[model samples]
Target: MIICGTNAGSPRCWMLVNDTVLTDVQGNGQIASASDISPPYPSQKSISLPSDGSLYSAMSSVTGHPGSIRRTFGSQKLLKTENVWLLNPQFAGAAIMPSTLKYKEEIYFFFSELNKTARVDEEPYRARIGRICTVDEGGIKALLADSWTTFMKARVMCGAGNTQQQYNNMKQAVVLTAQDKRAGVLYGLFSNAWGRTVICAYSIEDIDQAFSTSKLKGYSSPFVGSRPGMCVRKNSTTGGHNDIKNLGVIRYHPEIEDVIRPVGVAPLDLPTDDQITHAVADIVLAVNDEHYSVLYLGT
Candidate 1:
C-alpha cells in the first residue's frame, strides 16, 4: 500500500493486491487505505492526516510518482478518499512521514512540522507525532461545538527535561501492545539526534494520563541497535513475562532474498547492556502471503 498527498491536492492512499492496484469505492485514498499493509486481515480504510504540500510535492516530483499509488490485483491505481481528518485543527503546517502504526483500536500517525521558514530551527521547527481514535460506522461527526469531531489530538514527545538528547527528527513509530492474556504495555522505537533508541511507553489506552507527565524508558537489546521494530505474541507453552516474547532487531544477511528479517527470541533476560547495540536500523511490521512479518526500512 502507498499513501501520498500535496498541498494543493487531497491526501490519498492506495492498495497493491495481486499485482493490481485497488482504489476505494468512493475513491478517497486517505479513508480506504490500510494502516498496516501486512497483516492477518488487511483492512480497507485506516486513519490518515492532511499534508502541507511542500514536501509531498518534492517527493512526488523526484520519484515521478503521484500523490498515492499501490499495486493490487495485478494493476496500479490511485487512491482518493476523505473519510478521516485530524481533530487537532493545528496541523496545517505539518508534513507527515511515511510511517504509521495501528494499536488499541486506533491508528497512530507520526509527522514532522516545519515552521513558515521550512527549517527545523528553534522557531517551533521540530517533529510532532499524534494519534486519532477509530470512528465507528457513520463517518466522523462534529465535536462539542466548533471542534472537528472525527480526529483526536495526539501526544507529542520532545527530547527535553529528563532525557539527555532531543528527538529532533523522529520519522516513525511502531507500537506493540500486550493482549489480555499478557501484560498490557506499549513499546515504541523512534529516532533522535544521537541515533535510534527503544523506549517503553504506556499503552495507547493510557495516553491521556501518560502524556507530558510520563517518560518513555529504553529497553536493553543484544545488538548495536537503533530504530527497533517490535511485535508480541503468546507462547502458552513458555512461562515468563506471561509468555510475552519480544522479537529483537532484524538481521540483514547477504544470502537473504529480502534485505532484513526479524531476530526471533526473548531478550528480556539478557544481563549485559553490551549485548544490546548490535544492528541499528528502522524496522516496520508487514505481512506476506502466509503470516505476520517485520521489515527493516533503512539500510
Candidate 2:
C-alpha cells in the first residue's frame, strides 16, 4: 500500500490499499468514501500502519484546537483520536518535517514550536520530539475512549549544552534501521532562528527514557492540560464527581512537558557538513550490512 493524501500534494496521510479498487486502510473507503477518509485540514502527513490498522500524524491548529493522532474506520466512524504534543496552531508550532516514522512498534514525529521563552524575540522557535505507541488505541473506555494514553513530547536541543543562548527549530525527521531490519536511530535536521542548521541523532533508548521516566515537576498552571490529553474526556460525569475543580482533568503521566527543558536535553552527534540553509530537503538511512549502516542527508 502507498501513503497518499486527500488532496493532490498535501501531506494529509492515508493508507492507499492497492486492492482492485484502491481501498483506504485508515477508514477512508478507497472506492466509495474518499471524502470521509480525507484529513480534516491542511497539515503534515506523517503516516505509519501496523499489521491491522493505520495511524496518521498531524499538526494541531492554532485556533485553540489541538491536533490529534487519529485512526478512522470505514468512512465517518473514528476509532480513536488522541491529542498530540507540539504543532500548536496558536504559537505557530508545527511538525512540518519530511517524514513521520513508525519503527519497533513506536511512532515518532519531529517538529518545531514557538517557545514561551523570557527572550522570545531572540529564540522564538524550538525543535521538539514527539512519540506514541503503535498499538495504542487511545485510553480506557471510561477515563478516555479511543485515544492514546501514552503520547508525549520533549524539546530537542541540539548542541546547546544547557545554554539558553542557542535557538533551534526542527526542520526534518527520519528513522533508520539496521540490515537486520529493526529500529535503530532517529536523525533530525534543525536550524536556529538566526539561521544556522545543525543535525542531531537520538537512539531509541534516549527517546524511551524521556517518555518512560516520571514527569518532571517545576511549576503548575490551570491550563497545563490534563495528563493523557484527550479531547472527548471533557468532563467526569460517569463517576458523578461533579466537582468544578476537575476541569476535565484526564489524569496522565507526562513524559516531558510540551517542550523538553535544557537540562534533560541530550542530542547525539551525527557527521554532517553543517551549514546555514533554508532547510534539509531529504534524508535516508541505508544499511551496509548487519553490523553497519550509513546515514544520507541532503540539504
Candidate 3:
C-alpha cells in the first residue's frame, strides 16, 4: 500500500488508511470504525468484519530511540508482543535511512554515522553511510545471531577519490538498480561539508557486501557535482540507452573550479573522462521490492 503524508503529521506520520477515517486511540495509537466517533478517541476499539465478527486493532509504537524499529505490531488484549531492535544500540546516534530488500534470508538496514568529535573551528559533524544485515526470522535465534555473528560485523565506508576525505562528512542514500537483475548494483549519493557539492558511488555487491569490500579495487569513482539524489527504475517499459537508467538530481556552483553544470548518468562501462557528476538528495529504495533502503536521522 502507498503510505502518503508520512512526513505531514504533527509528529509527521500517515494516519488514514485507504481513505477510511481513523480515530486516535491514545497518544500513540489509532482506531478505525465503520462510522465516526465523538471526541476523546477510544484507546481500544473493535473493527467490523464481513462475517459480523470483530477484530481488535493492533498498535505500533515508535519512541525514536536508539535501536528502535519505527513500526511494530502488538495485540491490544494480550500485550505479549515484543519490540524488535534491528540494530545495535552502540550505533544509536546514527541516522537510520530506512529498510530495503531481504535477500538470502537477511534484511538490510542503511544508515549514516555522524562524526561527533568536537573541533576547534566548530564545523558541522560529517556523516558516512553504511549498511548492516540481520536475519528475517523473529525469535531468540534471530536476535542472538544479529547480536553476535562475526559475519554480520562487516561494513563498507564511502571513499572519496582514493582519499578518506572525499567521503568525509558524507551524507548518502542507497538503492538497487533493477537493470542488472543477476548482480544488482547499489548506487550511493553523498555530499561533503557545506553541502554545496555532491558525489556518487556504486558497488556490485549488495549494501552488506559493499560495506565489507569498500576498500577493495573495482569500486566506482567519487564523481563530483552539486547536490544529487538517485532515481532508479527497474524493468522500464520505457526504452532507454541502458537496460536500467540511473538518474540523479544535481545543482552546480559557478565559482568552484572543476565544477560542472547539469550532471548526468553515463553508462557504467563508459570511460570516466568527464562523463559524470554528483547528486543532490538521498536516494531511497523500496525495502520489499528492492534489496535495501537506508534512512538518515539528522540533516
Candidate 4:
C-alpha cells in the first residue's frame, strides 16, 4: 500500500492489485475519493506513515493562511496541531524515528517558518524540527481536546553559532538511524536568503536529549508532574494523568529554549557548489562489522 497527497494535498491510500491496474486500498474501482480529507491550499505538503498505520501530514502555509500538521486513518485517535503552533511555515520533509518503547516512537516534521518580527539585521527565515509521539492521543477536554499534547519543536541551526554564515532556510532533511534506533543522524539541506546552500548533519540522540531536558519557552516554573512532551504509557494507572497534565503545560508552551545545533557545531565542508537541490542519506554495512553513512546530493 502507498499513501500520498492528491494535487489538492488531500491524503489518499493506493494499492497495486496487479501489474496493469492500480486501485485504492478499498478496491473501489475508481481513483480514491478525497472527499474525506480537507486541508486547504496544500499544494506543497509533507506526509509520513508511522508504524501505527496513521498518516501524518503537514501543509504549506500560504499568505494569510495557517499551516497545519494532522494525523488520520489509523486505529488511534486523529490528532492535529493548534493553529498557533506554526507561523507561516513551509514544509520541507517528514520521517518516523523508532524508539525503545512502542509508544515512544516519534514522527518528525522539518520546515522553515517566516519570522514576521525579524530586525533589519536578522534573518527572516528560521529552520525548525518539530516532532510528536506516535501514541499521542490528543489532550484533555479542558485543554487541547483534539490537539497534540506531545508536540515540541526546536530551532535548527545549520551554520556556526550566531555567525553571518548561518543558513536560516531549511529546504530538505533525511534521517539515517541505527538498528537499535538509539543512534541516528539528521541530514538537512539549508539555504540562506541569498541562495547559498549548505548541508548540516545533526545527531538524533542530541536532539532527543534536548527536547527531554530543555525548558519551555516563556515558562520557568517547576513542572507539576512528568515533563511536558514526554511519551508516557497510556495504560499505566499510576501516571495516566501525567499525559493530561502535560497537555496543559505544552498547550501554552511548546517551543523549547535549547537550540539544536549540527554535529561539530557547523555545516559539512563539502567541496561542492553545484547548487544542491536535495539530499538523501543511508547507512551501509562495512566488512569491519561497522556501519558507514553515505549522503547523496542532487543538483
Candidate 5:
C-alpha cells in the first residue's frame, strides 16, 4: 500500500503502488522505462511519501513540479481530473499565501488574492478561503462539467476594520490539522504594504460560515460604499466565475465580520520596526477529563 503525494506548491496527484512490484519503481539505478505508465513523470516530482488515499497535497511552487490525480488498479488506471479544484484569476493575499485543512468530507485552501492590486483607490489585499467537497459530482455540459465546480472564496476580516488597507497581504497561515472539529481554530498571518503581520484566529464555526454562506452581489462602483465579500446566500441562477467573483463584492456580515474575529493583533514582542515572518500552531488537548483543546502558540 504505497501512496505517493506529489505537488509543486499547488495541485496534487495520488497513485498507489502494488505490493509485489515495489522493485519495479526504481530510483538512480537508471532503468530507462519500467513500463509505459511510470516513466512519463520525473521521479523528482514525487514527494515519495505514502498516501492515505485522500485527495490532499501541499508544497512550495519553487520546486517547479507538475501534479495530477491518478487512481491505479494493477496495470489499469484512470485520470481523475474531476477531483481537482482551483481558483480563477487567483484570489488576493499574495502577502500571506494559502494553507490546507480537511473539514467534514471537504478540503479547504486558505489563501487570498495573488497580488492585491487595489481595485478601488487605496484598497489593499483581503484574506480569503475556499473549499471543495470531495463528494461533488461536477456538472453537465458548459458549467459544472469539470472537477472544479464546488470551488468558491470570500473576504476575511482579521485585522482592524476588516477593510483593504487594514490587513492587505495574508502573509502566512497555520491550520489545526489534527484537532477536534469543534475545538479547532485557524490562525491566519496577515500584513500590509507598510510591513506588519497580524495573526488572527478564526473558530471552526466562523470559518465554516465564511465558506458555506451565500455570497453578495458584485460591486458596480467603489463609491457604492458597500464592502465586498459579504457572506449572504443569494437565489440567482447565474453560472461559474461570477460565483467566485461575487465573493469579492459581498455586501457585509455585521455580526460575523469585524466584531466576532480576534480583537487585536497577535500579542507578539517583535521589534516594531521589523515585519513579522512565519508561524506554526499546535492544538494541545487538555489533561485529565477535559472535553477541549488549547492552541499553544510559539513565536
Candidate 6:
C-alpha cells in the first residue's frame, strides 16, 4: 500500500509498504517520494487511484494556501484544478467510477467549501461533489495547458429543497456501487452549524445525469456541438478552435447550475448523534439473487 503525509510539517512525503515491511522491527518501506510538496496540515485530504494506475489527490488546509485537486503518476499529462475552483475547501472523500466508454471514466470528489463572505445568518459551508474525466489530458497550449478540461462541480443538498433544516457541512462519505458500476448510491454524512449530524443518500445515476446535462454556471449560449464536460477521444480531435473554445468555457465556468439533492429530499431518520466520525458501505449479494447495501458508521 502507498501512504502520504508530512515529514516535519513542511514538505509532504510518500511511502510504499506491505504487511511484512510494516510488521518487521527493522524493515523500512520503500520511499515513493521523499519530498512531495503540498499544503501544510492536509487534514482534509482525499486520495484515489483509478484502474489505469494514476493517483488523484485533493487537499486543503485551514491556515495555508487554497485547496487543489491534482492527478499524477500516470503516462498522461499532469492535471490540476485552477486556484479559483475551490475556496477554503475541506475534502471529505473521493472515488473512481467506470463508464461504458473507456475514455469517459470519471472520478468524483466530495468536499465542503467555506464561504467567507457569508452573512452572520447565512449558511457558511456548502457541500459539493466534483467530477473529472479520467482521460482528461489537460487543455490546449494557450489555455489551461496544465488544468483539467473536464472538471465540473455541483452543489449537494442534504435536506428538503430550500429548507432551513439543511445540513451544509459534509464530513464523510461512502459510495456503494453495483457490479456494473452504473447503479449505486452515495451516502454522505453531513452536519449542521448547530453540531447536529445526519446521513443523506444520493443516487449515483442522478448525479451522473446532472453532470452530463446541466448547463455551465454562467454560460447562456446553447451548445451547438459537444458539451463542455463531455469526454472525447483526443486523437479524433486536435486542440483546434472548437476544442480550445470548449476548454475556455470549462475553465471559466466549472460549476454547473443544477444542485444535487439527496434521494427522497431529506436526510435519513436514523437515531444517531454527532459521535459518528467515519462511514463505510458495501454491496451484499442476497440469496434471492438481489443485491443489498450494508452501511457501517463508526464513532
**Candidate 1 local lDDT, 75-191, one digit each (tens):** 112221121222111121211212233222333344444334444533333443433222211111221121111122233444433444544333444444343322223333334
Q: How far is candidate 1 from the true structure (C-alpha RMSD, Å)?
A: 17.8
Per-model lDDT? 0.28, 0.46, 0.27, 0.78, 0.39, 0.76
Count residue pairs with overlapping backbones in model 3: 25
The numbered model that scores best in lDDT is 4
Stretches of model 2 off by over 4 angstroms after superposition:
6-51, 60-66, 73-104, 140-142, 165-167, 178-183, 216-290
For 135-185, candidate 6 gives per-residue lDDT tens digits of 888777788887888899999999866778889999988987765466689
Global CA lDDT computed for model 3: 0.27
Question: Highest TM-score: which candidate?
Answer: 6
Please provide, for model 4 over 1-299, each residue's C-alpha lDDT reduced to its tens digit, 9 standing for 90 to 100: 54444535444555566655567566322221342233333454544554555567677786555777777556677778898899988888887878777778888899999888889988899999998988787776667767888899999999987777899999998988875485789999999878889999999999989988999999988887667788877622223566556666788799999999999899898989888998988888999999799999999
Selected candidate, larger lDDT, 1 vs 2? 2
Q: Candidate 3's residue-wise lDDT over 1-299, tens digit each?
A: 11222222222223454578643333433333212111112322211111011121122222342222211211211111122222222121122222243232222223333335636654344332222222221112212211212122123334433343443333333444443232434444444454533334444344433333333222233534211111122211132322112111011110111111111232122223331243222436575666353433232
* Ranked candidates (TM-score, high to low): 6, 4, 2, 5, 3, 1
Scored by lDDT, model 2 comes in at 0.46
Instruction: Give the TM-scores of the predictions, in the order they appear.
Output: 0.34, 0.59, 0.37, 0.86, 0.51, 0.87
Q: For model 4, what is the alpha-carbon lDDT of residue 54?
A: 59
Instruction: Report the C-alpha displacement of residue 57, candidate 1, in angstroms.
Output: 18
RMSD of each: 17.8, 7.8, 17.9, 3.8, 10.3, 4.1
Candidate 2 at 79: error in angstroms? 5.4
What's the CA error at residue 245 for candidate 1, in Å? 46
